[model samples]
Target: MLPAIVLSVTIARPWREVYEAFWRPEAFPRWASGLSDMALRPDGDSWVGEGPDGAIRVFFTGHNDLGVMDHRVIPDGGAPVHVPLRIIANGEGAEVQLTLFRQPDMDDEMFARDRRWVRKDLATLKALAERG
Candidate 1:
Protein backbone atom coordinates (compact mmCIF):
# COMPACT_ATOMS: atom_id res chain seq x y z
CA MET A 1 0.00 0.00 0.00
CA LEU A 2 1.08 3.57 -0.62
CA PRO A 3 0.98 6.10 2.19
CA ALA A 4 0.05 9.60 1.11
CA ILE A 5 -1.03 12.85 2.71
CA VAL A 6 -3.96 14.87 1.43
CA LEU A 7 -4.34 18.23 3.02
CA SER A 8 -6.49 21.32 2.61
CA VAL A 9 -4.90 24.73 2.81
CA THR A 10 -6.98 27.88 3.20
CA ILE A 11 -5.50 31.19 2.20
CA ALA A 12 -6.90 34.50 3.30
CA ARG A 13 -6.66 35.96 -0.16
CA PRO A 14 -8.50 36.20 -3.42
CA TRP A 15 -8.84 32.92 -5.29
CA ARG A 16 -7.51 34.28 -8.56
CA GLU A 17 -4.37 35.55 -6.98
CA VAL A 18 -3.69 32.24 -5.34
CA TYR A 19 -4.51 30.27 -8.46
CA GLU A 20 -2.18 32.25 -10.68
CA ALA A 21 0.71 31.74 -8.36
CA PHE A 22 0.17 28.02 -8.34
CA TRP A 23 -0.08 27.79 -12.13
CA ARG A 24 3.20 29.49 -12.78
CA PRO A 25 5.99 26.98 -12.61
CA GLU A 26 8.40 29.71 -11.70
CA ALA A 27 6.47 30.38 -8.53
CA PHE A 28 7.22 26.84 -7.37
CA PRO A 29 10.82 27.48 -6.44
CA ARG A 30 9.52 29.92 -3.89
CA TRP A 31 6.82 27.73 -2.33
CA ALA A 32 7.92 24.21 -3.18
CA SER A 33 10.86 23.10 -1.06
CA GLY A 34 12.17 20.16 -3.08
CA LEU A 35 12.08 21.94 -6.43
CA SER A 36 15.34 23.45 -7.53
CA ASP A 37 14.28 25.57 -10.51
CA MET A 38 11.15 25.54 -12.62
CA ALA A 39 9.97 27.26 -15.81
CA LEU A 40 7.57 27.03 -18.68
CA ARG A 41 8.71 27.16 -22.29
CA PRO A 42 6.77 28.68 -25.18
CA ASP A 43 7.24 25.96 -27.79
CA GLY A 44 5.45 22.92 -26.40
CA ASP A 45 3.92 24.85 -23.52
CA SER A 46 5.76 22.26 -21.48
CA TRP A 47 7.12 23.01 -18.03
CA VAL A 48 10.56 21.85 -16.95
CA GLY A 49 12.28 21.50 -13.62
CA GLU A 50 14.46 19.39 -11.36
CA GLY A 51 13.06 17.97 -8.20
CA PRO A 52 13.17 14.78 -6.20
CA ASP A 53 13.25 11.97 -8.75
CA GLY A 54 10.10 10.44 -10.26
CA ALA A 55 8.56 13.86 -10.91
CA ILE A 56 7.66 15.43 -14.24
CA ARG A 57 6.15 18.76 -15.32
CA VAL A 58 2.89 18.78 -17.24
CA PHE A 59 0.97 21.82 -18.45
CA PHE A 60 -1.92 22.18 -16.01
CA THR A 61 -5.33 22.71 -17.51
CA GLY A 62 -8.96 22.87 -16.41
CA HIS A 63 -10.39 25.62 -14.13
CA ASN A 64 -7.45 25.66 -11.80
CA ASP A 65 -4.30 27.60 -11.29
CA LEU A 66 -3.87 26.33 -14.88
CA GLY A 67 -0.98 23.85 -15.04
CA VAL A 68 -0.27 20.20 -15.50
CA MET A 69 2.14 17.92 -13.69
CA ASP A 70 2.90 14.22 -13.60
CA HIS A 71 4.67 13.96 -10.29
CA ARG A 72 4.11 10.32 -9.64
CA VAL A 73 6.11 7.24 -8.72
CA ILE A 74 4.93 3.83 -9.81
CA PRO A 75 6.30 0.67 -8.34
CA ASP A 76 7.18 -2.40 -10.35
CA GLY A 77 4.32 -3.38 -12.66
CA GLY A 78 2.17 -0.66 -11.17
CA ALA A 79 0.39 2.32 -12.71
CA PRO A 80 1.20 5.99 -12.52
CA VAL A 81 -0.28 8.14 -9.74
CA HIS A 82 -1.91 11.57 -9.82
CA VAL A 83 -2.03 14.67 -7.67
CA PRO A 84 -4.81 17.22 -7.94
CA LEU A 85 -5.33 20.73 -6.63
CA ARG A 86 -8.56 22.64 -6.51
CA ILE A 87 -9.05 26.20 -5.33
CA ILE A 88 -12.30 27.22 -3.72
CA ALA A 89 -13.54 30.74 -3.14
CA ASN A 90 -14.40 31.45 0.44
CA GLY A 91 -16.26 34.52 1.70
CA GLU A 92 -13.51 37.01 1.02
CA GLY A 93 -10.72 34.54 0.37
CA ALA A 94 -10.07 30.97 -0.72
CA GLU A 95 -9.15 27.45 0.31
CA VAL A 96 -7.32 24.79 -1.58
CA GLN A 97 -7.50 21.04 -1.67
CA LEU A 98 -4.15 19.44 -2.21
CA THR A 99 -5.05 16.04 -3.48
CA LEU A 100 -2.14 13.66 -2.96
CA PHE A 101 -1.99 10.05 -4.08
CA ARG A 102 1.11 7.96 -3.70
CA GLN A 103 2.00 4.43 -2.74
CA PRO A 104 4.06 4.89 0.41
CA ASP A 105 6.60 2.15 -0.14
CA MET A 106 9.81 3.87 0.81
CA ASP A 107 11.78 2.61 3.78
CA ASP A 108 11.29 4.13 7.21
CA GLU A 109 14.35 6.32 7.04
CA MET A 110 13.47 7.70 3.64
CA PHE A 111 9.84 8.10 4.65
CA ALA A 112 10.83 10.37 7.50
CA ARG A 113 13.02 12.41 5.19
CA ASP A 114 10.21 12.83 2.69
CA ARG A 115 7.74 13.78 5.38
CA ARG A 116 9.97 16.56 6.61
CA TRP A 117 10.29 17.88 3.10
CA VAL A 118 6.54 17.78 2.57
CA ARG A 119 5.73 19.40 5.88
CA LYS A 120 8.07 22.28 5.32
CA ASP A 121 6.74 22.71 1.81
CA LEU A 122 3.11 23.05 2.89
CA ALA A 123 4.10 25.52 5.53
CA THR A 124 6.10 27.54 3.05
CA LEU A 125 3.26 27.59 0.58
CA LYS A 126 0.91 28.88 3.21
CA ALA A 127 3.28 31.57 4.34
CA LEU A 128 4.13 32.69 0.84
CA ALA A 129 0.54 33.14 -0.23
CA GLU A 130 -0.60 34.78 2.97
CA ARG A 131 2.31 37.15 3.07
CA GLY A 132 1.84 38.25 -0.49
Candidate 2:
Protein backbone atom coordinates (compact mmCIF):
# COMPACT_ATOMS: atom_id res chain seq x y z
CA MET A 1 0.00 0.00 0.00
CA LEU A 2 1.15 3.55 -0.60
CA PRO A 3 2.08 5.85 2.24
CA ALA A 4 -0.60 8.39 2.93
CA ILE A 5 -1.55 11.40 5.04
CA VAL A 6 -4.87 13.06 5.80
CA LEU A 7 -5.04 16.83 6.14
CA SER A 8 -8.03 18.89 7.15
CA VAL A 9 -9.40 22.33 7.84
CA THR A 10 -12.29 23.35 10.04
CA ILE A 11 -14.81 25.63 8.39
CA ALA A 12 -17.31 27.81 10.17
CA ARG A 13 -20.20 26.58 8.07
CA PRO A 14 -22.59 23.71 8.03
CA TRP A 15 -21.21 20.55 6.45
CA ARG A 16 -24.06 20.28 4.00
CA GLU A 17 -23.78 23.95 3.09
CA VAL A 18 -20.05 23.72 2.42
CA TYR A 19 -20.46 20.57 0.37
CA GLU A 20 -23.25 22.07 -1.68
CA ALA A 21 -21.19 25.16 -2.42
CA PHE A 22 -18.07 23.47 -3.76
CA TRP A 23 -18.48 19.79 -4.60
CA ARG A 24 -18.56 20.17 -8.36
CA PRO A 25 -15.57 19.63 -10.63
CA GLU A 26 -15.72 23.20 -11.91
CA ALA A 27 -15.40 24.62 -8.40
CA PHE A 28 -12.15 22.79 -7.74
CA PRO A 29 -9.87 25.21 -9.53
CA ARG A 30 -10.98 27.95 -7.18
CA TRP A 31 -9.03 26.29 -4.39
CA ALA A 32 -7.06 23.45 -5.94
CA SER A 33 -4.25 25.37 -7.56
CA GLY A 34 -2.30 22.25 -8.38
CA LEU A 35 -5.13 21.00 -10.55
CA SER A 36 -5.73 23.94 -12.83
CA ASP A 37 -4.04 27.10 -13.96
CA MET A 38 -7.33 28.86 -14.68
CA ALA A 39 -10.67 27.03 -14.98
CA LEU A 40 -11.93 23.58 -15.86
CA ARG A 41 -14.33 22.90 -18.69
CA PRO A 42 -16.68 19.95 -18.84
CA ASP A 43 -15.68 17.15 -21.15
CA GLY A 44 -18.16 14.32 -21.16
CA ASP A 45 -18.04 12.59 -17.77
CA SER A 46 -14.88 14.41 -16.77
CA TRP A 47 -13.44 17.94 -16.88
CA VAL A 48 -10.41 19.19 -18.75
CA GLY A 49 -8.11 21.99 -17.65
CA GLU A 50 -4.63 23.37 -18.04
CA GLY A 51 -2.36 22.23 -15.26
CA PRO A 52 1.16 23.33 -14.46
CA ASP A 53 2.61 20.46 -16.45
CA GLY A 54 0.11 20.81 -19.28
CA ALA A 55 -3.45 19.61 -19.77
CA ILE A 56 -5.20 17.34 -17.32
CA ARG A 57 -8.47 15.46 -17.15
CA VAL A 58 -10.30 15.10 -13.89
CA PHE A 59 -13.06 12.70 -12.90
CA PHE A 60 -15.04 13.76 -9.86
CA THR A 61 -17.34 11.75 -7.65
CA GLY A 62 -21.01 12.26 -8.31
CA HIS A 63 -23.03 14.36 -5.92
CA ASN A 64 -24.77 12.47 -3.14
CA ASP A 65 -26.19 12.93 0.32
CA LEU A 66 -22.90 11.86 1.80
CA GLY A 67 -20.17 14.47 2.09
CA VAL A 68 -17.82 12.69 -0.29
CA MET A 69 -15.94 14.82 -2.81
CA ASP A 70 -13.33 12.45 -4.16
CA HIS A 71 -11.70 12.91 -7.57
CA ARG A 72 -9.25 11.25 -9.94
CA VAL A 73 -6.77 13.43 -11.81
CA ILE A 74 -5.02 12.30 -14.95
CA PRO A 75 -2.18 14.52 -16.08
CA ASP A 76 -1.30 14.62 -19.71
CA GLY A 77 0.50 11.39 -20.58
CA GLY A 78 0.75 10.59 -16.90
CA ALA A 79 -0.91 8.15 -14.56
CA PRO A 80 -4.04 8.99 -12.63
CA VAL A 81 -3.89 10.28 -9.05
CA HIS A 82 -6.76 9.72 -6.69
CA VAL A 83 -7.64 12.47 -4.21
CA PRO A 84 -10.08 11.65 -1.44
CA LEU A 85 -11.82 14.66 0.08
CA ARG A 86 -14.71 15.04 2.48
CA ILE A 87 -16.65 17.52 4.54
CA ILE A 88 -18.00 16.22 7.82
CA ALA A 89 -20.06 17.77 10.54
CA ASN A 90 -18.11 19.24 13.44
CA GLY A 91 -20.68 20.52 15.82
CA GLU A 92 -22.42 23.40 14.07
CA GLY A 93 -19.50 23.75 11.69
CA ALA A 94 -17.68 21.45 9.25
CA GLU A 95 -14.32 19.82 8.85
CA VAL A 96 -12.90 19.51 5.36
CA GLN A 97 -10.41 16.70 4.98
CA LEU A 98 -8.15 15.56 2.17
CA THR A 99 -6.04 12.43 1.91
CA LEU A 100 -2.70 12.51 0.14
CA PHE A 101 -1.15 9.32 -1.12
CA ARG A 102 2.57 9.11 -1.67
CA GLN A 103 2.95 7.73 -5.17
CA PRO A 104 5.43 4.96 -5.99
CA ASP A 105 7.79 7.31 -7.80
CA MET A 106 7.72 9.98 -5.09
CA ASP A 107 10.64 10.61 -2.81
CA ASP A 108 10.39 11.99 0.71
CA GLU A 109 10.87 15.51 -0.61
CA MET A 110 8.23 15.16 -3.28
CA PHE A 111 5.72 13.76 -0.83
CA ALA A 112 6.41 16.57 1.60
CA ARG A 113 5.87 19.14 -1.12
CA ASP A 114 2.56 17.64 -2.09
CA ARG A 115 1.52 17.62 1.54
CA ARG A 116 2.26 21.33 1.82
CA TRP A 117 0.37 21.98 -1.37
CA VAL A 118 -2.69 20.21 -0.07
CA ARG A 119 -2.51 22.05 3.21
CA LYS A 120 -2.41 25.39 1.43
CA ASP A 121 -5.28 24.43 -0.82
CA LEU A 122 -7.38 23.39 2.13
CA ALA A 123 -6.71 26.74 3.77
CA THR A 124 -7.81 28.51 0.63
CA LEU A 125 -10.98 26.45 0.58
CA LYS A 126 -11.69 27.38 4.14
CA ALA A 127 -11.31 31.06 3.40
CA LEU A 128 -13.57 30.83 0.40
CA ALA A 129 -16.22 28.87 2.26
CA GLU A 130 -16.19 31.19 5.24
CA ARG A 131 -16.29 34.38 3.26
CA GLY A 132 -19.40 36.53 3.59
Candidate 3:
Protein backbone atom coordinates (compact mmCIF):
# COMPACT_ATOMS: atom_id res chain seq x y z
CA MET A 1 0.00 0.00 0.00
CA LEU A 2 1.18 3.53 -0.69
CA PRO A 3 1.76 6.02 2.07
CA ALA A 4 -1.11 8.44 2.28
CA ILE A 5 -2.17 11.57 4.09
CA VAL A 6 -5.61 13.07 4.36
CA LEU A 7 -5.79 16.84 4.54
CA SER A 8 -8.91 18.78 5.23
CA VAL A 9 -10.35 22.24 5.61
CA THR A 10 -13.60 23.47 7.09
CA ILE A 11 -15.54 25.92 4.99
CA ALA A 12 -18.35 28.09 6.18
CA ARG A 13 -20.91 26.74 3.77
CA PRO A 14 -23.40 23.94 3.49
CA TRP A 15 -21.92 20.60 2.46
CA ARG A 16 -24.18 20.07 -0.52
CA GLU A 17 -23.71 23.62 -1.68
CA VAL A 18 -19.97 23.31 -1.42
CA TYR A 19 -20.03 20.04 -3.31
CA GLU A 20 -22.16 21.53 -6.07
CA ALA A 21 -20.02 24.61 -6.26
CA PHE A 22 -16.83 22.82 -7.17
CA TRP A 23 -17.67 19.36 -8.48
CA ARG A 24 -17.40 20.20 -12.17
CA PRO A 25 -14.22 19.53 -14.13
CA GLU A 26 -14.05 23.17 -15.21
CA ALA A 27 -14.13 24.32 -11.61
CA PHE A 28 -11.01 22.41 -10.57
CA PRO A 29 -8.37 24.77 -11.92
CA ARG A 30 -9.80 27.61 -9.86
CA TRP A 31 -8.27 26.07 -6.71
CA ALA A 32 -6.73 22.65 -7.31
CA SER A 33 -3.41 23.97 -8.55
CA GLY A 34 -1.76 20.68 -7.75
CA LEU A 35 -4.07 18.94 -10.19
CA SER A 36 -4.36 21.19 -13.22
CA ASP A 37 -2.48 24.21 -14.45
CA MET A 38 -5.49 25.59 -16.31
CA ALA A 39 -9.11 24.91 -17.09
CA LEU A 40 -9.98 21.30 -17.92
CA ARG A 41 -11.96 20.69 -21.07
CA PRO A 42 -14.35 17.80 -21.38
CA ASP A 43 -13.10 14.91 -23.44
CA GLY A 44 -15.44 11.96 -23.68
CA ASP A 45 -16.00 10.71 -20.12
CA SER A 46 -12.95 12.48 -18.69
CA TRP A 47 -11.31 15.90 -18.81
CA VAL A 48 -7.94 16.90 -20.20
CA GLY A 49 -5.79 19.75 -18.99
CA GLU A 50 -2.23 20.93 -18.72
CA GLY A 51 -0.83 19.63 -15.49
CA PRO A 52 2.29 20.62 -13.59
CA ASP A 53 4.53 18.14 -15.34
CA GLY A 54 2.69 18.09 -18.65
CA ALA A 55 -0.68 17.09 -19.97
CA ILE A 56 -3.03 15.06 -17.81
CA ARG A 57 -6.36 13.33 -18.13
CA VAL A 58 -8.69 13.34 -15.16
CA PHE A 59 -11.77 11.29 -14.40
CA PHE A 60 -14.08 12.55 -11.72
CA THR A 61 -16.94 10.82 -9.96
CA GLY A 62 -20.29 11.56 -11.49
CA HIS A 63 -22.59 14.01 -9.75
CA ASN A 64 -24.53 12.40 -6.90
CA ASP A 65 -26.36 13.22 -3.71
CA LEU A 66 -23.41 12.03 -1.68
CA GLY A 67 -20.49 14.41 -1.31
CA VAL A 68 -18.04 12.23 -3.20
CA MET A 69 -15.59 14.21 -5.29
CA ASP A 70 -13.05 11.51 -5.98
CA HIS A 71 -10.94 11.71 -9.15
CA ARG A 72 -8.24 9.90 -10.98
CA VAL A 73 -5.39 11.76 -12.68
CA ILE A 74 -3.30 10.22 -15.40
CA PRO A 75 -0.24 12.13 -16.49
CA ASP A 76 1.08 11.82 -19.97
CA GLY A 77 2.18 8.25 -20.46
CA GLY A 78 1.90 7.66 -16.72
CA ALA A 79 -0.22 5.48 -14.52
CA PRO A 80 -3.43 6.75 -13.04
CA VAL A 81 -3.22 8.35 -9.59
CA HIS A 82 -6.36 8.14 -7.56
CA VAL A 83 -7.26 11.16 -5.48
CA PRO A 84 -10.08 10.72 -3.02
CA LEU A 85 -11.93 13.87 -2.05
CA ARG A 86 -15.07 14.41 -0.07
CA ILE A 87 -17.24 17.15 1.35
CA ILE A 88 -19.18 16.28 4.48
CA ALA A 89 -21.31 18.21 6.88
CA ASN A 90 -19.65 19.82 9.85
CA GLY A 91 -22.27 21.54 11.94
CA GLU A 92 -23.60 24.34 9.78
CA GLY A 93 -20.50 24.31 7.59
CA ALA A 94 -18.69 21.83 5.37
CA GLU A 95 -15.54 19.80 5.89
CA VAL A 96 -13.61 19.03 2.74
CA GLN A 97 -11.11 16.21 2.83
CA LEU A 98 -8.51 15.20 0.24
CA THR A 99 -6.25 12.19 0.36
CA LEU A 100 -2.72 12.54 -0.98
CA PHE A 101 -0.95 9.34 -1.76
CA ARG A 102 2.81 9.07 -1.81
CA GLN A 103 3.79 7.27 -4.98
CA PRO A 104 6.08 4.29 -4.74
CA ASP A 105 8.95 6.16 -6.40
CA MET A 106 8.56 9.37 -4.39
CA ASP A 107 11.18 10.37 -1.86
CA ASP A 108 10.48 12.07 1.44
CA GLU A 109 11.14 15.54 0.08
CA MET A 110 8.88 15.03 -2.92
CA PHE A 111 6.07 13.74 -0.76
CA ALA A 112 6.48 16.67 1.61
CA ARG A 113 6.30 19.13 -1.24
CA ASP A 114 3.14 17.49 -2.56
CA ARG A 115 1.63 17.59 0.89
CA ARG A 116 2.34 21.29 1.21
CA TRP A 117 0.90 21.92 -2.23
CA VAL A 118 -2.32 20.14 -1.30
CA ARG A 119 -2.59 22.14 1.92
CA LYS A 120 -2.22 25.39 0.05
CA ASP A 121 -4.76 24.34 -2.52
CA LEU A 122 -7.22 23.33 0.19
CA ALA A 123 -6.79 26.69 1.83
CA THR A 124 -7.54 28.38 -1.47
CA LEU A 125 -10.67 26.25 -1.81
CA LYS A 126 -11.75 27.14 1.69
CA ALA A 127 -11.39 30.84 0.99
CA LEU A 128 -13.31 30.58 -2.23
CA ALA A 129 -16.13 28.57 -0.69
CA GLU A 130 -16.52 30.94 2.23
CA ARG A 131 -16.67 34.02 0.10
CA GLY A 132 -18.98 32.59 -2.52
Assess candidate 3 and give its lDDT.
0.94
Sequence-dependent TM-score of model 3: 0.98
Sorted by lDDT (best first), the order is 2, 3, 1
Q: List the pairs of residues colliding in candidate 1.
A: 2-103, 2-104, 3-104, 58-68, 59-67, 59-68, 60-67, 60-68
Q: Per-prediction count of colliding residue pairs?
A: 8, 0, 0
How well is each residue in 1-132 modelled by candidate 3, as lDDT tens digits?
A: 998999999999999999999998889899999678888999999999999999999999999898999999999999999999999999999999999999988999999999999999999999999999
**Model 2 residue 35 CA deviation in Å:** 1.0
lDDT of 1 by residue, 2-120 (tens): 56666666779887787777755566668765654454332355454554563445444434443232243232244544555566788788776665544456677776676667667
lDDT of each: 0.59, 0.94, 0.94
Tens-place lDDT per residue, model 2, 111-132, is 9999999999999999999992
- What TM-scores do the predictions have? 0.64, 0.97, 0.98
Could you tell me which 10 consecutive residues in candidate 3 have the lowest summed lDDT?
A: 34-43
Clashing pairs in 3: none
Please report the TM-score between candidate 2 and the true structure.
Answer: 0.97
Order by TM-score, highest first: 3, 2, 1
